[model samples]
Structure formats: C-alpha cells, structure tokens
Target chain A: MLLQFIIGLVFGLGLIVSGMSNPAKVLNFLDFAAIRSGTWDASLAFVMAGAIAVTFTGFKLVLRRPQPLFGEKFHLPTREDIDTRVIAGPAIFGIGWGLSGFCPGPAITALGFGTAAAVIFVAAMLAGMWLARFIANRPSMSGIVTPADRVGA
Target chain B: MPATSFTPVASAAGGALIGLAAVLLMALKGRIAGVSGIASRLLPPYEDREFAGRLAFVAGLVAAPGLVWLVSGRLPEQTIEAGMPVLVVGGLLVGFGSVWGNGCTSGHGVCGLSRLSVRSLVATVTFMATAALTVFIVRHWG
Candidate 1:
C-alpha cells in the first residue's frame, strides 16, 4: 500500500510539474492548427515522448525477468483483438478530451487544486462511469468494457 | 512553427515522473498503473488484495497538490475553458469511452504501448487522431 501511495504521489507531482493540471495548457495542446500556426501550445508532445521513452526502456529491462521484482506475476492486458470496443470507446473519449481539455488522470489530480470545475467534472465522470455499467448490461453489445472493465482490460 | 507559451522541459520532466511511477507500480505490485482501472477498482463492487493499495494510490494522487501547497506555499494554476454543461458531457464521454475502450492515456498510451501491444498501438493512434479532429472541429469549425 505504501509503495502504491508513493507511486501515486509521484505521479501527481509529475502532473503538476508537467503542467497537465493546467487545463489551458492542455486545451492548447489539443489545438492542432494552433500548434501548426505556432500560436497556442504543444507541450504534450514532449510529455508523451518522454513518458513513452522511459516506460519503453523500463518495461524492456524488467519484462525479461521471470516476474516482477516484488510480485508473483505480471498483470498485463490480455485482450488483443481490435474490436468495436477498441474503436468506438476511444473515439468517444477523444471527443470528450477535446471538449474539456481534461482526461482521467489530469482531471482527478486537478481536484487537489480545489477547482469547482474539477469537482463538477469528477462527479460527472463518476456518474458517467456508473451509467456505462448500466449500459454494459444490454445483451447486444455484450462484453463491452465500462465501469467494471480492467486488467489487459 | 516556433513553439510559444508551452514549457516542453516541464512537460518532459513530468512525463518522466509519470513513467517512473508506472514502472514502480508494475515492478513492485505486478500491475499496470492505469488510473481509471485502479480508481474504479477501489469502489465497493471490487474486492481483493489490491484494494488497499489502490485506495492509497488514489488518495496520494488526490493529495499531492495539497501537500505541495502545504510545503511550497502555492497551488498550481488551473483553467477549464468548458462550462458546466460542456464539462458534464465531456466527463461522461471520458468516463464511458475510457471504460469502454478499457483504458485511457495511462493504460493504453503508457503501459500497453511500452509492452509493444498491437491493440494499444491501434487504440492510441485511433484516439489521438479522433482527439485532434475533435479539437479542430470544436475550436475552428464550431
């Protein structure tokens, strides 16, 4: 628990330092034309590249071992198929991200900043999660990912 | 185009920190540090050995800024351009889409891609393109 807490703390601090908690910064990052026009902002490129670089190296170094250093097994994603779930979910999520300029992690971490906007966004996010759970029950698009999904999930 | 009004150094540093956190969680707990997955699993419906760690992680995430303020004497600046209605719709889309996609930037973008998962690659590319298009439409055309 302590380990996880420390990780979370570091991640949160990282968000702050990365300027991700600042929605204006994020909003500008999504503005492609502004990015091309050199007017708005485009810092997320660095963020993504840096994060991916580190994780790419770390995972390469660690995955070769029989298992994780502290745990019995590694819990990576299991599903590989690019089904409807893969396509539609992220498309919708992308639209939401563009609209609010906040994704899950930044939105959650921003709550620590005590913005009423963050508070409302978080509440609606949770509600939306619950609504997904309810929607996942229908038989047609069965096995859909949602409020209850995870693990190679 | 010359960069303006964006701090690449800060973003890279923070991204590095986030990557380190993901590595730590995976190496220590044998789990992917997907925020939505971890946060959702903390709710009542899911119960397991992982619950305590998940809760603690989320608590720490939610408190880092507060701690920074207590120590550094300043809260990080934040701005959400979207109004309440827009935020609500956006939040719902994020919640539902992320859950439906089975991961967000953290899960698929960071963790899955690190492992070189093809599904993650597809998901990431798809979302990024859609996000860019969405932003273009909303900001420019709309």
Candidate 2:
C-alpha cells in the first residue's frame, strides 16, 4: 500500500511539474484555430516520451526477472487485433480531447490542483461510469462486459 | 510569447511519459496502472489487500506534478470555457464511458494497445469516437 501511494504521489507530482495539470496548456495544443500560437503547449508529448523510454527499458530489464515487486508474474496482454470498438473509442476520445483539451489523466490531476471545474468533470465522469453499468445491463448488451466493468471489482 | 514554450516537445514527451508510467507500474508493482481501477478501489467494499496498492497508485498520480514543480519552478496554467455544468456533465459522461469502455485512453489507448489486446482496441475506439462525436455536436450544434 505504501509503495502504491508513493508511486501515485510521484505520478501526480510529475503531472504537476510537467505542466499537465494546467488545462490551458492542453487547450492551446488542441486549439487548431490559433495555428502557431505561442499559447499552444504540447509538453504532454515530451512527458509521454520520457515515460515510454523508461518503460521500454524497464520492461526489458524486468522481463529477465522471475517475478515483479507485488504480483506473482507480469500480466502483459497477448492480443493484437484492431476491431470496431478500438476504432470507435479512440475517435471519440480524440474528439473530446480536441474539444475540451482535457484528457482523463490531467483532469484528475487538475482536481488535486484545486480546479473547481475539475470537480464537476470528475462527478460527471463518475456518473458516466454508472451509466455504463446501466447500459451494460440492457438485454441487447448481455454478453458484452464493457471495459469499465472489468477495472476494479 | 515567452520565447521558451516547449509545447510540441511537451506533447510528445507527455505521451511517452504516460507510456513509461504504464510500463513501470506493471514491472515494479506487477499492476496494469489503470487509473479507473486504482481510483475505484480507493473507496467502497474495502478490500484491504488491494486497497494499499490502489491508494499508492492514486497518490503517485496526484503527487508527480508537485515533485516536478519543486525542480522546474514553472507551473502549468488552466483555463476552462465550458463552464461548470458542461464540465460536470462531460465528466460524468466520460466516467460512465470509462466504466462502459473498461478503461480510459491511458489504460486502453497506451497500455492495452501496446500489449495488443483486442478488447482494449475496441474500447479505445469506442472512447475516441464517442468523444469526437460529442465534441462535434457540442461545438457545432450547441
């Protein structure tokens, strides 16, 4: 638990430091109208790059080990086929991101940074989650257990 | 124009960082580093064994920014034009979407996609498309 918290703290702090908590920065990036506007901030890419670099290296190192820090073994997924769901969801997310300039990660981080607006966003996000459950329960959707259903419990 | 904005670089970096975080979490904690999973477990049914790890993950997310601030001396600024109602509504929709989709962009788009999970691919597509449609309607119609 302590380790997890520490990890989360580091993650959050990284967001803040990287300027991800600021919606304006994100908005600028999405603001296509202001082409070349100094306001456009794409710092997220760098942050992501650093993370990816580390991750690629880390995974290689860890793969040699017998097990991980907490669990019995690495739980890497082994499926690689794109489908309708993949196409649709990413498109939707991109649209939302372009429009709102706030993706889920930074939005949550924004909440901790004291953005009242973030509070509303978080609430709505939760509501959306609940709505998924309702939708999943529909007769037509019986066999489909949305990703939301598989997250925690 | 401060003559020192690294927006382009930052965006790429941020994306990579997200990817890295996912990898590390999986390697170090043997976890998927899914935000929804971590946050969801923070409250509710009370599973002690899982609680600590989830809590820690959330903590890292919240605290990473502060740590950066300590060294960089520059904090990102935020601006929201959609107002409170819209943000709330949008967020709720997204939260629901996250649940229904089984994961958010980070979880599915980055992590799941990298691992090549068919489910993740589908979920990511759904999330992206919905968000795009919503944005178009809101921007053009609303």
Candidate 3:
C-alpha cells in the first residue's frame, strides 16, 4: 500500500512539474490553437511517450524473469474481442479529454497540488466509476467481466 | 519567452521517451504501465504488490522531466482557459468514463491497442467519439 501511494505521489508530482496538471496546456494541445500560435504545450505527449518507453522496456525485462516484483506471475490481458462497452467508454474518455483538457493522471496529480478544481474533478471521476458499475449491473446489460476483474479487488 | 512553450524537438523527444518508457516498463517490470490502474491503487483500498511497482513507475514519470531539463534547455508551458467549473466537471466525467470503459487512454490506447486487443480498439473509438460529441455540445450547443 505504501508503495502504491508513493508511486501515485510521484506520478502526480511529475504531472505538476511537467505542466501536465494544468488543464490550459492540455486544452491547448488538444485544440491545436497552441500549435498555431507557436506556443504549443506538447509536454503531455512527451510525458506519455516517456512513460510508454519505460513500460515497454520494463515489461520485456520482467517477462523474462518469469515473475513480477511483487507477484507470482505476470498478469497480462488475454482477450482480444471488441464490444459496445469498449466503443462507448473510449469515446466518452476522448471527449472528456478534449473538452476538459484534464485526463485522469494529471487531474489526480493536480489534486495533490491542492487545486480546488482538481479536487472536484477527482470526486466526479470517482462518482463516474461508481456510476459505471451501477449502469453495468442493470438487468439485460449482460456485463462481461474482463481481466481487470481478476486482479485483486 | 517563458519556459512553458513546446519546441518541435522536445515534443518529438517526449513522445519517443513515452514510447521508450512503455517498452521498458513492460520489459523490466512485466507490467502494462497504465496510469489509471496505478493511480487507482493509490486510493484507500490498495494492494501491496501493485503498490510498489506503481510508486516506482510514477517516480520515473516525475524524474524524467527533470532529467530532460538538465539535458535540454527548455521546459513546456501551460495555459488554462476554461474556468475551474468546466475543468472539474470535465475531469469528473472522464473519471466516470474511464471506470466504465475499464481503462484510460494509456491503458487501452497505448497498451491494449499495441497488443491488438479488439476491446481496446472499441474503447478507443468510444473515448474519441464521446470526446468529439462533448466538445461539440459544450462549444456550440451549451
């Protein structure tokens, strides 16, 4: 638990230092106006790229070891099917990202930075998660549990 | 000029860095390096094993920028236009959507798509579509 909190803290702090926690920069990047004005805020892309690179290399190394740092085996996704939930979920996420300029990572990071708005965003985000659960549980929905369900809950 | 503006090289470098990080985390840690899952663990109910890896991953994220600053001479700039209310609401909606979607952009778009998961493709499409609609409604209708 401590490890997770520390990791989250570092992640959030990184967002703040990288200017990712700032919604204006994110919005400008999305709208392309910043690029037009020659004041682009491409840090989000950079941060993401850096993160991806680390993940790629890190996963390769760990996979060879036959076990994760804290687990008996590496947990990877096995399913490859697409469905309605997948389509609807991403579309909603993208729209929110484009509209608010504050995706989950930076938003939480912003919360750590003590932004009132960030706090509100996190709250709403949690609510959204619960809402998703509620909606999924509704009858006739035929909810399909993914790999995420297998993870320790 | 302020230290927050983006340069072409920095942008490209950043993207490359993220790609590299993604690959590295997978190789070294044998994990997907999804921020949502990592951040989610930070909440009250946490898992021990996931907690450590999450912290290290996040640390690397924060430290990379400082490292870049030392190598390069510039830092990215930020500007916020929408009021707090809009940002807050939008963020909340995204959180909800991510939970519903079972992943965020980094999870599905980067990792899942790379693995060619059809579910990720669907999720990515959904996220983008909803975003486009939201922007339209907020910018024009609302």
Candidate 4:
C-alpha cells in the first residue's frame, strides 16, 4: 500500500512539474490559434514523448519476468478488438479534455490545491462515472462490456 | 492572457518521473497504473480487494501539492479558465468518457502506447484528433 502511494505521489509530482496540472498551460498547448500567432506551447508533446520513451523501453525489459514481484500474474488488458465504444468513448473524452484542458490525473492531483473549481469538477466527474455505470447496468445493456467491466477485472 | 511557459526540461523530467511511477507499479503489483481504472474501481459496488492501496494512491496524489510547497516554499500557480458551469459539464464528460473509453491520457496515451497496444494507439489518435478539433471550434469558431 505504501509503495502504491509513493508511486502515485511520484506521478502527481510529474503532472505538476510537467505543467499538466495547470489547466491554462494545457489549454495553451491545445489552442491551435496560438500556433499561428506564435504563442503555442508544445511542452506537452515533449512530456508525452519522454514518458512514452521511458515506458516503452521499461516495459520491454520488465515484462520479460515471469511475474511481477508481488502479484501472481500481470493483469494486463485482455481485449484487443477495436469496437465502437472504443472510438466513441475516446472521442467524447477528447471533447471534454479540449473543453477544460483537465484530464483525470491532473484534475485529481489538482485537488491538492483545495480550489473550489477542482472540488466541483471532481464531484461532477464522480457523478458522471456513476451515471455511466448506471446506464450500463440497465437490463437492455446486459452482456455489453463497458469500461466498468474491463477484461482485467 | 495566461502565458504558456515553455518548460521542456522540467516537462521531460516530470514525464520521466511519471514513467518511473508506472514502471514501479507494474513491477510490484502487475497493475496497469491507469488512473481511471484505479479511481473508478473505488466507486460503488466496490469489489476490489486492493481498495486500500488504491485509496492510498489517490491520497498520495492529492497530497502532492503539499510536497511541492514544502520543497519550493509555495504552492505552484494554477489558472483554471473554465467557469463553474463549464467545469461541471467538462468534468462530467471527462469522467463519463474516460469510463466509457476504458482509459485516459495517462492510461492510453502513456502506458498503453508504451505496451504497443493498437487499441490504445487508436484511442489516442481519436482523442487527440477530436480534442484538437474541439479546441478549434471552441477557440476559433465559437
């Protein structure tokens, strides 16, 4: 438990230092108008690049082990087929990200600031999550695997 | 106007830290370190045996600003441009969409892409495209 907490702390620190925790900075990166006007911030691209570079190489080395140190097996995602939910869900998520420049990690991490806006966003986010589960639990939606029922779980 | 600070070094360092965190999680727990997965699983009908760990992870994340303040002598500046209504709507969309999509920027963009998952690649591209388009419409055409 402590290990996971430390890992999350590290992740949160990364979000802050990378400027992902700052919605205004994130918006500036997303704003294409800034590109033409010479105000665009491309730092987020570098953040992703650096993160992917390290993880890509790290995973290659780490997954070679028979099992994780503490667990019996790696519970990686089992599903591979590209489905409509995959497309539509991310598309909708993208719109929200563009709208507010705040994604889940940063939004949660930003709660450290104790801002009312962050609190409100998080509360609404939880509600939305509950709503998604509610929709998927309807009798007609049975057998359809929403994210609530991911293969790993 | 909010100024965009070009912080390549700090951003890269931060990214590396995040990658390190992901690596540690996989090495230790065999988990994906997906924030949405971790966070959402904590909600109702809670069945995860690892609930305590997940809650601790979130607590640590929420406490990060305090860490920064301790080291830097002040909280980092954050500007939220979206008002209450927009924040609420956008928050709901983000929460719902991430749950419906199965991941978010951290999961799909960082960890999933690292594992070379085609599904994550598609999700990443789709979201990036739609996000860019949304920004265009909101900032330029709105």
Identify the leading candidate in terms of TM-score. 4
Residue B62 Cα positional deviation in candidate 3, in Å, after optimal superposition: 11
Q: For residues A1-153, what per-residue lDDT tens digits would candidate 3 score against the true structure?
A: 344334434444445554565666555455443455666566666655555555545554556676656545666776566655566666677876877777776665454344466567777776666666666655656555433432211
Q: Score every model by TM-score.
A: 0.91, 0.75, 0.70, 0.96
- Comparing 2 with 4 on lDDT, the higher-scoring candidate is 4
What is each candidate's DockQ, to 2 decimals?
Answer: 0.62, 0.42, 0.33, 0.75
* Residue pairs whose backbone atoms clash in candidate 4: none
Identify the superior model by DockQ, candidate 3 or candidate 4.
Answer: 4
* Cα interface RMSD of each candidate: 2.6, 4.0, 4.7, 1.4
Stretches of candidate 1 off by over 4 Å are A137-149, B1-4
Cα lDDT tens digits, model 2, B28-140, are: 76767667555645544443467766756766666665665676765455567667666765565556555444566567766665655678767765654555455445544
Of candidate 1 chain B, the 10-residue stretch with the lowest lDDT total is: B39-48
lDDT string, candidate 2, A67-90, tens digits = 887677775544445444445445
Worst 10 residues of 2 chain B by lDDT: B1-10
Alpha-carbon RMSD to native, per candidate:
2.8, 4.3, 5.2, 1.6
What fraction of the genuine interface contacts, i.e. the true contacts, does candidate 4 reproduce? 0.74
Model 1, total clashes: 2
Candidate 1 DockQ score? 0.62
